[model samples]
Target: MPLEFEKPILELEKRIQELKETARTTGVDLEAEIRLLEERLARLKREIYGNLTPWQRVQLARAPGRPTTLDVLEKAFQDFLELHGDRAFADDPAIVGGLAYLEGQKVVVVGHQKGRDTKENLQRNFGMPHPEGYRKAMRLMDLADRFGYPFLSFIDTPGAYPGVSAEERGQAWVIAQSIQRMGRLRVPAVAVILGEGGSGGALAIGVANRVLILENAWYSVISPESCAAILWRDAKEAPKAAEALKLTAQDLLRFKVVDAIIPEPEGGAHKDPERAIQNIKEALLKTLEELKGLSPEALYQDRYRRFRALGVYQD
Candidate 1:
């Protein structure tokens, strides 16, 4: 169920609909009243959304209507040229990669995609990549390297596909190879966790010079549900597990897991997707500008240090 504040927003929408029907017969000046109610509802939502718990933020991040990779692609990139096939197997829809323009800057774009509807979700394997998907991503990484174009990746997935078919084709090997190849790629690369960044699936393309995460998005070594099931024998303990995971953007930055956190609008990126995209655009432009001048060898050394320095402890 949605929160209490959402009820008034729903009610106001219902009342507006009824008023519209009544207007056909009574010719009443309901527009003013409807607008006022809408404004009031908006204020109420802002109040409720102002202070959200970690769990509430998690809910917002996984909201079904949240924007996907394609949504952001259409918004922030132009002149896209999609490449196909892993040259080893069939094309995998779970991973999408191609060349595109980021504010007229030629760049290689890649991301995990989870479809919005049932059929599409099934087709996308619930955003879990198979061996072919990882291979395809590595192919694109090579393309980006050869051309000297900056690489941009979006991370969003539960995990890599764990089905028999995927494993039969060596899923683990492909994922590891992707990361291994990325570490040596001679280019300025940036990775953003736009949604769920689960396990090695997210890590496949996350090796980069600058890693950015959305304020509510999560990036974790293992998913909370997976950890709960293993530890407590109940997936319902995921909430508690999430508290221990420290996967949120701010937490990730504090742990030295990522370079930066991109703030979302009030509530989260879903509250206003355009605003979220704009914020991401600004961050990417800034990072690219900052890293563009570094030599390829310098970029590689920095990327290695960035990953090596994560989650250190000293006594």
Candidate 2:
């Protein structure tokens, strides 16, 4: 989907078409003038995308064409073998994890998968996992560790499913188990917040030796809207909550909540998804390489310190 700012650019292109039609109809020479107008339109698009506001960035991150978890798997992984089912109950499409090859090395890839359309959205629960989904992640993660394959998780959920079925299935317990298992996993693990990383749904897979986030991806304990609802009793106050939550990649990096921020294309990742995937692939390769050198003791020490060091008071 095109950004609202792109509407004017599209309108300009339409007008350029009208000019060409008028020139053709009247037998007038306007080719040179058309070229000039086209060049100006292209330059205007570049300028508009160069300095997008935070909210606009958010809109782009959730855009329909924005790269999904499966899209990244296709671009960044080779020989992916999808593993399904929690082994205890039904398979949840909201969380997908399996074996894949990254940079010629075997690895486990897991992520929250959102649907591309309305019917699929209902099927995937809009990327919000239930207890079984988290349970499945734990099973895959355990397999990765047992096989000595590094783990990579892409977080892009609004939150875990809060419906009665999810609660009945022990959603909180499953999420907590995932967090504990991920943190204690002996193999190297990296997490990237590809889009909205909200609440425990994100945190379950987020504990890692290295955490990367796209420039526009937001990670927060509670979503801005949720925070606004709790604090102000108005969802319309989300913008203010977003500002205070400091959930943007830049803010999280500055606060030492994540290891690094992956640069997205101007106008966010949806602008050019291949480039975005390339950035993530490069970051993941670099992090995996770095983690390979660390001993188990060092990995545990540093990972523990990384979490403990957050929220430190500095005067």
Candidate 3:
């Protein structure tokens, strides 16, 4: 079912579909009717999406149909040879990475992978990475640095796994180390927030020379529900928390937390994934081109400077 705000658009679409079906069955000309309805649908989509609230955008980011890391990899890259395991503990399905070719340029691609259904979600731990996941990502980053392959990361995690077993495995230390290693990475790196970029789990792979975000994606220190619970003692206040957090891509762009905003399709990325992936491909190529000539020292310095410049200060 469509969200409350999207009901009108969906209803119009349903009517258009019905008219097309009737035309097919009865030989009556419904072209004029369908055309009018299509125009209305376009306008309605623009008007609704243009004025979406932060909370609404958050919902869209978490939409089940939104493209996942694997989805983007299949569409946007080629020859993905998936590498796994932390070489210490077991392999975590939440984070997937390996060597891939982007527009014929060999690069290391890593990202959080969320499952599409209940069983798969359980396997992915709802995209909450564990210690092994972070370690595996760090390993891939190191490999990319060693081979001089530009690192590309897609961040979409709720947070690091908070389960007892994950903590026992030193999840916090793994996350911290991943962040530290990323900070000093010798090769050019780019991270795109495809969906929910939450807390250290997201940041563990997010330190990049160029950080891009999808139009409806979010990057935040904490999830809105968690923040709401901490601030208002109730999770139902999440909408308010989302508004206050300034976590939307647009907000982060204005704050200079992100390098660029990759535009999504009319309703969202899920509506037109091919177009969304194409937009991401264009953005990544542009970023890689911009960073192509930089030396290793320059890459590190650029990344350091980018993160260092991420706060408000008054002269």
Candidate 4:
């Protein structure tokens, strides 16, 4: 079911689908009706999506049908060879990465992977990576740097795994190491926030020369629910916390936290994932082109300067 705000759009879409079915079954001329309904659907979608609240946008980012890292790979890349394991502990399914070809250019692709169903989600650890995942990512990133392959990362994790076993495996240390390694990576790297980007888990793979975000994605130091619990003593105040956090793409763009925003389809990315994937492909190509000319030292320096320039304040 669509969210409350999207009911009108979905209703109109349903009507259009019904009209098509009727036309097919009864041989009635419903072209005019279908056309009118589609126009109204388009307008309704634009009006609703364009005016979404931060909390509403957060919901959309977490929508079940939203494209995942594996989906993006299947749609936008070619010859993907998934590399596994950290060569230390076990292979973590929450983080997936390997060599892939993007528009014929060889690149290293890495991202958080959340599953589409309950069983898969459990297998993926709800996309909350453990220490092994971060280490595996760092290993692939180092390989990319060594082989002169552009590194592309898709971030969509709730946070690092907080379970006792993850902590026992030095989760914090591995996350810190990933961040440190990414900061010094000599190759061109780009990261896109496909959905939720929470805390150090997201940042571990997010230190890129270019950071892009989907229109409805949210990136924050903490989840709104968690922040609300900490500040207001109740998780029910999450909507208010979301408003105050400025985690939306537009807000982050204005604050210079993101490099670009790739606009989603009318309702959201989940509603039209193929279009969203196409938009992302275009953005990646353009960004890669822009970064192709820089020397390794220049790439490192530019990435450093980009992060350094964030959080300017006037008091």
Candidate 5:
């Protein structure tokens, strides 16, 4: 199903299809009319997607069929040897990590993995990691540091699991540990916000030398719906809260929260997954190339300075 804001675009597309079918079946020459509608469609896409509000971008980030971490691993990298288990407890499916080759350069990749449907969502816990998940991520970071491989992380979770079981197992502590681990890694690290990037779940693996986000992705401490519920006592006020939170990619880029924005295909990533993943591949390779010359100590200092400079205020 198309999102509410996308209905107009889809309706126009449907009309164009109908006209094409009519012309084909009735042997009518509608080439001129079809060409006009095609031109209008291109302009409509730019007008709508190019001017998306923060809330609309959020909707796009959460849209169904948006490419998942596994999808990127498959399409953007090669020879992904998935590693499981945190070595302390059972492995958490919400977080996935492995060794992969990016344009023939070995790297360690870790990310939150959401599912495609309700049954799989339940199994993946809606991409909300538990303590073990963060631990697993830390394990991968350690591997990267040990082998001098660059680290790549994908951020795409609503938040860490908040249930009593997760808490009992030390969710917050593990998250903090993961953030500290990523910060201290000697290898170059880069993180991309593929989707939601909500709260500690995203940040646990997100501390890196360069943080990038997709054009339609968002990164925030809390989701707009949750913020609206808390601030306005109504979830329906999420659009207003979204504007106030400044979580969109453009907003984050303005604030220097993200280093760069990878442009998505028209409509959204789900509309053209291959193009979106290819964009990510190019960005990652370019960023890694930029970081290639820095020594390990230089990389550490670079990351330290980058983060220490965040949120600086002027009187």
Candidate 6:
């Protein structure tokens, strides 16, 4: 389904398609009309996608059929050997981690995975990780450190699970531990925000030397709807809240929250997932190469400085 904001473009495209089909069947060249409509379609796309607001970008990040972590694992990496179970409890499908070969260099990859259909979403908890999920991520990071392999994390989650059962399992504590573990990792670490990087769930595996985000992805301490509900007592004010939050890639780039912004295919990653994944692959290879030159201590200090310099304050 096309998003509400995208309806105009889709409608225009449909009209252009209908015109072309009419010309094909009737043997009358609607060449001039089709050309004009095609030009208009191009401009319409540029206008809508180029000037997307934060809320629109958030919608794109959560767009149905947008590439997920599993998609990247299958396409971006080679010879993935998935590791399961947090060792203390059952495996959590929301968080996937394992060994993978990136351009022939071994690395540990971990990310939040959302299911494509209704059944998968129910199983993956809508990409919201539980306590065990965070634990599994930490274990993967530990493996990366032990083998002196670079750590690559993909962040795409709304937040950690907020259910009573999740809390009973120490959701907050495990997320904190995961954050601390990422902070202290001796191996080079890179994190990519593929889509909705929200709250502690995103941050748990997001503490890395280099943080990259997709052009339309968003990363924030809290989701806009939740922020709206907290401040205005209504979720309907989410657009206003999203504007205030500064979560979009452009906003974060200006704030230096992200190291680099990987451009997506025009319209969004879902429109051309293969190209989008290739762009991410190129960025990852470049970032990993840059980080590989530093020693373990240097890598740790680099990560420390990068995060420590996030916000501006004056007294």
Global lDDT of each model?
0.86, 0.87, 0.93, 0.94, 0.94, 0.94
> For residues 166-243, what per-residue lDDT tens digits would candidate 5 score against the true structure?
999998899899999999999999999999999988999999999999999999999999999999999999999999
Q: Per-residue lDDT for 1-315 in model 6, tens only?
A: 999999999999999999989999998989999999999999999999989999999999998888899899999999999999999988999999899999899999999999899999999999999999999999999999999999999999999999998999999899899999999999999999999999999999999999999999999989999999999999999999999999999889899889899999999999999999999999999999898789999999999999888878896
Sum up the clashes in candidate 6. 0
Per-residue lDDT of model 1, residues 1-315, tens digit only: 455435666676688778777876899878887788778867876776775655566677777767788888889888777887899879999999899999899999899999888899999998999999989999999999999999999999999998999989998999999999888889999998998999999999999999999888888888888988988889888878888888777788888888899888876787689999988889999999999889999999999988887756787
lDDT of 3: 0.93
Minimum summed lDDT over a 10-residue window in model 2 is located at: 51-60
User: What TM-score does candidate 2 reach?
Assistant: 0.91
Clashes counted in candidate 5 amount to 0
Kindly report which residue stretches of model 4 are placed more than 4 angstroms away from their true locations once superposed. Answer: 15-39
**Alpha-carbon shift of residue 161 in model 5 (angstroms):** 1.1
> Number of clashes in every candidate structure?
0, 0, 0, 0, 0, 0
Clashing pairs in 3: none
| Candidate 6 lDDT for residue 310 | 80
What TM-score does each of the candidates earn? 0.88, 0.91, 0.95, 0.93, 0.98, 0.99
In model 2, what lDDT does residue 69 have?
Answer: 86
Q: Count clashing residue pairs in model 3.
A: 0
- Residues forming the 10-long window of minimal summed lDDT in candidate 1: 1-10
Top of the candidates by TM-score? 6
Say which prediction, candidate 5 or candidate 6, comes out ahead on TM-score: 6
Off by over 4 Å in 5: none
RMSD of 4: 2.0
